[model samples]
Target: MELQVLVLRPIFFFFFFVFLTILQQSSSARVLTITKPDRHDYAASARWLVSQNSWGVLSTLSVDHKGAPFGNVVSFSDGLPEKGNGIPYFYLTTLDPTARNALKDQRASLAISESPLGTCTRDPMNPTCSKLTLTGKLLILEGGSEEAEVAKKALFTKHPEMMDWPKDHDFRFFKLEIIDIFLINWYGGAKPITVDEYLHAKSIKLASFL
Candidate 1:
């Protein structure tokens, strides 16, 4: 009886250890799964968010002594997405102080958002808000390059009134070369998208931006 009891005790301990190990692994996997975002869902939602709004806040660092951040509400013309390019690019004109500061500093961020249109009362049909944040470096196009010409033409097409501005004046065309992009859909419930995934899912042709 003593021999039998010792053998059973060792077997029980081994099974118990295996059970705990399996439980720990299961818990870890659950945590990882919860944290991971669904790339497909994020990509689709990000595209929708951009399509919903034509304007966004253009944020740039101040070039003055303060070196603070400044945001401006600007009207933007949307660019179509191309494969390997994340969300579409946008164009807007700015001669304001913010633009000048950004030109001197080159680092900037752009944000676009959309909220429930009518009353504060929440409706199931429109229970959520969305926003996209883009971090990139701004490059000022100078001289007579084909790219500059195309940017000018596209700008004019979006804003016909701009044509009335004097021709001799230096109208700087800025190309935002995106470095990192993030999209939060349904206020953080949906998955988030990184710049690489965005570019991979969409195709942005140069002609479209031009």
Candidate 2:
């Protein structure tokens, strides 16, 4: 009986370890399985970065700091998952310095990277990792308007918690009217993609990447 107990103990531990290893591999696979657009397709690549990401750094000229550039981490959405318009929408309040700075100086930019998407196998700073900066004016939409309604749906769908945020805090919808786009997806310098090329680029179908 003592011999049987000792033999069974090692067998039980071996099986348990195997189960844990399998589970860990499965989880990693799920995270690393994301498919990104080809780096050569500049417009599609830029749109992909914006669509896949839920947040980015929004930089505005600081009103308090005497026109110095101020960058803040902000949550944003282009549209529903796999459906994006290439325009970034944000939910913000005057209570936050970012919102206040935008109101004072509409000139701003939103920077997004592929690092958070888990598709980048290289260092985030590596050129192959891909990054984008959309320079434009940040404008607050009217409380009740056709465009504002669209913004609300686009935002709430991606970030459900925004729907429950404190109303009294006065969070309003804002959008970056992209005037210039800077993208780097490969070893070369910035891509020569025009604004029209980006906004009117073929909409990325989820099936294409999958």
Best-fitting candidate, scored by lDDT: 2
lDDT of 1 by residue, 40-107 (tens): 46665554444334457778887664788888776444342222123323343455665687668888
Clashing residue pairs in candidate 2 (N, C-alpha, C atoms within 3 angstroms): none
Estimate the lDDT of model 2.
Answer: 0.89
How do the residues 1-210 of candidate 2 rate in per-residue lDDT, one tens digit apiece?
999999999999999999999998866543422368888899999988888788999999999999999999999998876567889999999999999998888999999999988778999999999999999999999989988888898899878999999989989999999999999999979999999999998877754232
lDDT of candidate 2 at residue 115, scale 0 to 100: 91
Top model number, TM-score:
2
lDDT (Cα atoms) of all candidates against the true structure: 0.56, 0.89
Candidate 1: segments with Cα more than 4 A from true spot: 1-40, 80-94, 116-127, 187-190, 203-210
- Per-residue lDDT value at 137 in model 2: 99
